[model samples]
Target: MLQVGPDLVCIELKGVNAYLWTGPGGPTLIDTGMPGSWSQLVGDLAAHGVKPGDLKRIIVTHADFDHIGCLKALKAQSPALVACHTVEAVYVRGEKSKPANPSVLGYVVHPLMAGFQRRYDLGVWQLDELVVEGHVFPEGFTALHTPGHSPGHMSLLHKQAGILITGDALSNHKGKLSLPMVLATPNMGMAVESIRKLGGLTYETACFGHGPPIVGGASQAIAAFAQTL
Candidate 1:
């Protein structure tokens, strides 16, 4: 785990990572990992002398299964408010808008895994807050509307730490920095454009949902990754 700022603590899971930002108001848990990883997540927090049940809020970057599998589990234990973008908020609350299946490649793989979510009755969890651009959290953090991977996708920016919590808008998976999965995006153009905008931000850390974090030169790295689109 890396403490990027006074309030921000990042915990890296096997395939993805979640960020915890605590202040006078308690803690906000970023993305939850894939299904069946909740035990490990809770255990890790316990090991660090933090209780997952004390989380103040749970902020979802987007509504992918891998990122939200533990939403209900976490909510059941904590009184923390759950927040997501308007577009994604509906899905989290069990209202199906549009599944994010984007390409033939994704269609084949998505259904195989999505079936489990359906069978398990993993409806979208409820959201207490709708995050958008200009929404400011404690400690000088702002939400940036970085859409296209999923409509209303959001990234959190901490001006003080120069850190941007990029859900799946950008990735370091497979040992290289790149854009989100093309086959999983609703609009590749919009995703690329979003990346370009984030690329211009003055951030030193780019924390992602998958793989490792980018420690510095965020603006240039993001721009270069967007260029690949």
Candidate 2:
């Protein structure tokens, strides 16, 4: 678990923590873990002083298998409104399953994923609200559309906390590379551009999906990461 600011705690659940952030009225959870993880997640939340029913919003950065895999389960347990970018709404709602790249390599492996996808019963989610530029979230947070990992992918920016919850835009794990996450989005160019965009922002800490969060010197870390490209 990592703390970006006084009230914002990012609990990394080894698999994925249903991130909970408290506000004036209640707490907002981001990225529910895989299904059947409710009991453990609840235990963690309870330990942190948060209850399942206190969740206000379930903000999914993107509709990747690991990111939003537990959305349906969490929504059923809690009344939190699920939200995602407009481009990803269909996938989040299960109306459209994840599409594979048409590349030769992609075709070779797409068939292997059929069973896994079926087992998860992955579905698309509805966009309760669209997150665009200048959108303020509860407790002084803002949403930034840092796509490329997935079309319409987003990252939450906490201006007051100087923290950037980068979905998969910039990974600090397995040799930091300014590129699209493996098996995620296919476009590498878009991924690089997205990282550059994030580098321009003023932030002190960066939280990622896979690697450990970068606590300080965000600009330097990003610039150095760009050089590795």
Candidate 3:
């Protein structure tokens, strides 16, 4: 785990990353990592002095299996309120078998990706809160709706820290920023628009769901990438 900001630790699970924020209210988790990652997540939190019971809430950026794979297990242990965008709530609750918006390639590759799908044990779960664009959490992070990768994908912005937690809306591969794969990202046009939208934000650090974080000059990097779109 890496402490990206004051009381904000980035927990890496395999290649995916989850974040832990400690505040006066306790700890809040952002994304839950892939399946079979629950034990390590709990251990990491404990190492940071946050007990499982100390978790106050779990914020899901989207309904991707990798993002929410351990959600059910974590919630069973912590009972933290699971919050996500209204559009994504359906997938979290198992009302939909897959993300509402999947790239055209996803439709073609989904069948062949059964082994990958089997890694996640998705099921129905109650959402404690519905988040929307501009909604601010108690921890001071504001929700920014950046769909395309998924119909209700969201990125979080912590203005004071100049940090943006990009939940698959953007990714960092080998220190370079890029969009999620088109095969997995159903709506490329909207995804491109979302990338342009992110460029409008002010941030110096960006934490991606995949790859290492860019701790400085994040906004400039985003703008430069936007021009290529």
RMSD of each: 2.2, 2.4, 2.0
- Candidate 2, residues 155-204, lDDT tens digits: the string is 87887778787877766665454455445565666777788878878888
For model 2, the stretches where C-alpha displacement exceeds 4 angstroms are 24-26, 111-115, 124-126, 174-178
**What does the lDDT read for residue 88 in candidate 2?**
68
lDDT of 3 by residue, 94-147 (tens): 666544235556776865543354446564378898989999988888999998
Question: Could you tell me the lDDT of residue 136 within candidate 3?
Answer: 90
lDDT of 1 by residue, 1-229 (tens): 7776666777776677888777545567888877778888898677666786778788888877778878888888888888888767766665653354567877776666556656555555567888778797754568888988888788888887688999988788776887788767768778888888888788888888887777778767887776776
Q: Estimate each model's TM-score.
A: 0.89, 0.87, 0.93
Candidate order by decreasing TM-score: 3, 1, 2
Off by over 4 Å in 3: 99-105, 112-119
How many steric clashes between backbone atoms does each model show?
2, 7, 3
Query: Candidate 3, residue 135: CA error in Å?
Result: 0.7
Question: Which candidate number would show the highest TM-score if scored against the true structure?
Answer: 3
Off by over 4 Å in 1: 3-6, 23-25, 100-102
